[model samples]
Target: MDTLVLRLQPGDDLRAALDAVLKTDGIGGAAFVVSGIGSLRGAGIRFAGAETATRIEGDLEILTLAGTLSPDGSHLHLSVSDAAGRVSGGHAAPGCVVRTTAEILVAVLPEWRFSREPDPQTGYAELVPRRRSSQTL
Candidate 1:
């Protein structure tokens, strides 16, 4: 396993940057953990069994960001706190703009490859892991 640390500059979209890294670096499998003070000009979050994400507006502090990242895609969740201490958390979608910066930590698994496949039980695509090479652990 290896770790990659990133600091996103102001005005950068958090998810966009992450996706770029996944594509550019060819990260087959990884876990993303992010936390920092920033603003989400507009954030998209999904609650409960909803099929789509709800848009949230305003400057917020990123309390938590955690999820799995793969070359196929990512499933990230984000929690942010507002000025009044109100906290909101859900699926981290695109369009989450950065205020000052976003610090992210990625744990890369070089020996594994991750992909999303359709799951009949849940009706949603889920992560599927496979060995990258035919080597014993």
Candidate 2:
């Protein structure tokens, strides 16, 4: 596994930036967000069982961020605290705009490939991890 540390500037979209990392040359086909913390002007979080994300507006601090990254897509979860110290956590969605800076640590798995496939049991596309034939531990 290879490690990557990223710093996102103000106005950057948290999810979009992370997505772009996968497209970078030599990054590999799969990664895991080991840790992340940052500040956001606002964020969009999809709560449990909710079909759509709820937009949260304010000076928010990202308390936690972690998840899987795949070529097909990513599944991330985050927790944030508002200026008032109110906390909210849910599935991380796009449109989370950075306020100050976002520091992220990712572990790139070069020997593995991750894809999203429809699962009959969950009725949703889920992560499918596989080893790369050309690589070995």
Candidate 3:
């Protein structure tokens, strides 16, 4: 297991930075263990049990970020606040922009793999794991 520390500066796209890390590192599978305190210019998030997403265009502060990564796609959950500290969060999707800066700590998990596939019962994309041998020949 390894951890990649990221420091995003002003005018940088927050989500884009993380995605870039994954693409650059070729991290097909991993999980975010810790995120940092930072500010964003604009953000878009959707709550659970909802279809349409809402956009918040203002000074946004990332309070917390939790999620997993996989080859299929990265499953991310996030929460943020405005200048007043009013909080709103949900499944990490597209259109989440950054304002000032954001510092993040994304953990990389090796050997173990994560993926999202269709779930017949729930009709939602769920996380699934792949098994690998611990022993060497």
Candidate 4:
């Protein structure tokens, strides 16, 4: 396993930057361990059964960011705190802009690949591992 650390600058889109790195590096499978002190004017979070994210406006501190990401797609969760110390968390979506910086470490699995496929039972696109095919000499 190899690791790649990314420092996202101010005014950068958090989600987009992460995605760009994974795509650019051809990282098919990875686990993102992310952290940093930053601010966001607004954040979009997806709650249960919601088709899209719910936008919240304010300058907030990123408290918790955890999730799995792949070239095909990503499943991330985020929590932010406002000036009043009120906190909100949910599925992290696009439009999460960075105020200061965002540091992310991606642990890459070079031997494997991942893709998202729709599950009939769950009705959601789920992560599916695609291992490298091998052949005996």
C-alpha lDDT of candidate 3 relative to the true structure: 0.73
The residue ranges of model 4 lying beyond 4 angstroms of the native Cα positions read: 26-28, 34-37, 134-137
* lDDT, each prediction: 0.77, 0.94, 0.73, 0.76
Candidate 3 structure quality by residue, lDDT tens digits, 1-137: 77888778887766666656656655546455476667877777878998867888888888888777666676677889988889999976777776666778888876676778999998889989875446510
Clashing pairs in 1: none
Clash pairs (backbone) in predicted model 2: none
* Regions of model 3 farther than 4 Å from truth: 25-28, 134-137
TM-score, each model? 0.88, 0.96, 0.85, 0.86
Residue 97 lDDT, candidate 3, scale 0-100 = 71
| Total backbone collisions, model 4 | 0
Candidate 4 structure quality by residue, lDDT tens digits, 32-91? 555544677788889767888999887888888777677777888888998899998888
lDDT of 1 by residue, 1-137 (tens): 87778889888988878777666555556455544445666677886678888888888888888887777778888888877888988888888888877888877777887788999999999999888666733
Ranking by lDDT: 2, 1, 4, 3
| Candidate 4 minimal-lDDT segment of 10 residues | 28-37
For residue 15, model 1's alpha carbon misses the true position, in angstroms, by: 1.2
Could you say which candidate leads in lDDT?
2
Model 2 stretches with alpha carbons more than 4 Å out: 135-137
Candidate 2, residues 1-137, lDDT tens digits: the string is 99999999999999998888889998988999999999999999999999999999989999999999988888999999998999999999998999999999999999998999999999989999999886454
TM-score ranking from best candidate downward:
2, 1, 4, 3
What lDDT does model 1 reach? 0.77
Task: Give the better candidate number (1 or 2) by lDDT.
Answer: 2
